[model samples]
Target: MNHFASIARVPGDPILSLMEAYRADSHPGKLDLGVGVYKDAQGLTAIPKAVKLAEQRLLDSETTKSYIGGHGDPLFGQLLTELVLGADSQALAEQRVGATQTPGGTGALRLAADFIRHHLPTRGIWLSDPTWPIHESIFAEAGLQVGHYPYVGADNRLNVEAMLAALNQIPQGDVVLLHACCHNPTGFDLSHVDWLQVLEVVKARELLPLIDFAYQGFGEGLEQDAWAPRLFAEALPELLITSSCSKNFGLYRERTGALLVCARDTEKLLDIRSQLAFLARNLWSTPPAHGAAVVATILADPELKMLWSDELSNMRLRVASLRDGLVTALEPHGLAQRFAHISQQRGMFSYTGLSPLQVKRLREEFSIYMVGSGRANVAGIDAERFAQLAQAIAHVCVE
Candidate 1:
């Protein structure tokens, strides 16, 4: 017998596996609202116009192929910092902020996990109970114990009281992972007032807050979307932010993201940055160049940046409109009352509150695909299919 026979099969990813099943279905009206990736009205994921223009500009340049520093391109990091932290951010002005480019949001998360493990090895990580599944898995893989904090309530809203209770129980120095904006899966997010409360708790407990900002421009305007992270950085003595361009810039395949560490002391900031660079050296040597270059180009050019913001706002409005349409279409079927929560939720996803059996029925009967947990990517639905989707969901959800 071969000595290598102990390898066991790992299960497929739930979201991607659903995508494969959707593709294999030959049903003419099959709908896919499973995956987290954004899709336009035409159901296509096209590159942002700003990105296309930037690529053209890059093609005109004649740059060397020399290896970038372990922190990746310096200019790209600067551009990303300004884009995420704002031009007049006090953190940047005081030299208390440090950043490193990564493959994307996932890479940033992994890097942050490693940083936590190295700096605060004794403290575990606390995540929202129904946060993006990968957060817990990534932290656990980094040799950190992971715990959960209550987030969503039975009424399909943020359980602020319960979340506060959970936060109070967390030990000092523990890392608390927060979805800066656009909470995934459930789409329920904290209100500005709620954010202030959570910030107070973090400050009081001396907990480290790691903000995951993947869909910044998807819920609101870029500046408005960055308010939470900006506020946290300004108020908290220590913070870490993982910002991604995958969704807003449509650079998913390019894998563009940055990790920002904010410390009260400049000397400490320098030390943390060095450790991040050392980790990068071992992880992938250096980050990719193309995606960050494109983003930097767009951000550096005023005209291009304005155009990108306008396009992002349009996408946000369209998704919100689709959420409204779904509710309207389900009114006659008596599901409007039940699904009103969908319209109330923000960002690209909405937990439809459908039971597992109902989700299964939608797929088996109507060729409409959604996560078994009833999370639907609202951006995946267009005007042409809104009525059909509503009807399918309503039919399956009938008592």
Candidate 2:
């Protein structure tokens, strides 16, 4: 009589809970560092000028609402492939790389996971110790074994040596999921030298590389941020890359992304893509069109592409500036050294080295919100309130 009564309620996500708490707080100084969305200096989530232009172009020229195939828009996929792997890239030139549109980066990851589960079920997914929390659940939910190598530790530092050491020992042919750039949460990225070392480990241990390239242009320049994935693609006979247009293109809601597969040859890539299309058919019927269309329009047009790149550069620089500004602000409080790594880390987030106790105080006493793990959305910071935040952090650190 009560079939639903057997289900138990689960607690809300911590980040969502923080959002609710932030909204209900009466304090005017309340700061929300919880959500992953980007905010400008004025604290508004902006639509880039290029996006508006592209939307207008779509409005004027669009004709059909018909399905764009299981792989989504062909042009979007083509352009996105070039964007991730250069037009002159060997994979593209040799016709060994394939891409299929997905709902978003998350969808791309799920699609890839399902593809792997169906085709390469024996391969365990190796994630970073402190990777995006959802990665663990996504792969596990797909019935794949999930494992982690060393990454950032409680001391809020990168353990690259440990990471390299662990990767050297993981079972051969297991899949290793690596953030292409702008690593989440900890924001600590492997340097060029470090990546080379990791590549050696990946080669020595014979691990498959699955590069999660969500924030392509969010770290340094677009090309600069893409170095790791490009290197991996060029070096490995086969690689998996999931590219998202959410952050750089400001198409967060539109959910534009692609799952890219590179193989040793065209025939293998064809077989692999066929499998992905089959998995995608059951997953979402077909990916959304408007976002992919918009992305295609912008990337294909020379003028619009330049404008979009400039705007993306602005966003990337703004976040980097915020990192520096926060550090400069912290200097007066004498806490700069403790959190110096924040400046060194590139991306929209930083592990501020604050313990859970200090973070609790910031939430309850100062109306400042961040994840319990001390992960702060550096983009959500108010440039004007740097000193105030520094003072608040200083107080919490000492008191």
Q: Which candidate is the best by lDDT?
A: 2
Report, for all candidates in order, the number of backbone clashes. Answer: 0, 0
For model 2, the superposed segments whose C-alpha errors exceed 4 Å read none
lDDT of 1 at 3: 86
Model 2 whole-model lDDT (C-alpha atoms)? 0.92
Which ranges in model 1 have alpha carbons more than 4 Å from their true place? none
RMSD of each: 1.1, 0.9
lDDT for every model?
Answer: 0.89, 0.92
Tens digits of per-residue lDDT for model 2, 282-389: 999899999999999999899999999999999999998999999999999898888889989988988888888989999999999999989999999999999999
**Model 1 lDDT tens row, 129-210:** 7989898789999999999999996666679999999999999878899998889879888889999999999988999999
Model 1 earns a TM-score of 0.98
